[model samples]
Target: MGGATTEPADEKPAVYYANCAEAKRAGAAPLHRGEPGYRKALDRDGDGVACET
Candidate 1:
């Protein structure tokens, strides 16, 4: 008798793309300036906090 075969799981689930650029070009809020992965896209002066609000 042949047993049931299992397929590899998709490690990268759908949620992985939830916040990806492809998901929303607008992009999500940052984890506070000067933090990790803090792209200076908004902070022109690179001083963190775009306008010092």
Candidate 2:
């Protein structure tokens, strides 16, 4: 008798980051909430805004 083997699934989601300061040379506009840059720039504490506070 043959049995099928099952594999465990990945629990962690993929993460992305915004452009670095070096990339923009400090002249790039700031990112706001709900933006890609904001998602990468701000540090979340308990699912709330941390960097802005």
- Overall lDDT per candidate, in order of appearance: 0.42, 0.43
Question: Which parts of model 1 have CA positions greater than 4 angstroms off?
Answer: 1-38
TM-score of candidate 2 versus the correct structure, residues matched by position: 0.25
Task: Count steric clashes of candidate 2.
Answer: 0
Candidate 2: segments with Cα more than 4 A from true spot? 1-23, 26-28, 40-53
Give the Å shift of residue 52 in candidate 2: 10
Q: State the weakest 10-residue window (summed lDDT) of model 2.
A: 22-31
Tens digits of lDDT, candidate 2, 1-53: 57986556865443334444432444333434564344534544434332343
| Cα RMSD of predicted structure 1 | 8.7
Error of 1 at 50 (Å): 1.2
Q: Lowest-scoring 10 consecutive residues by lDDT in candidate 1?
A: 14-23
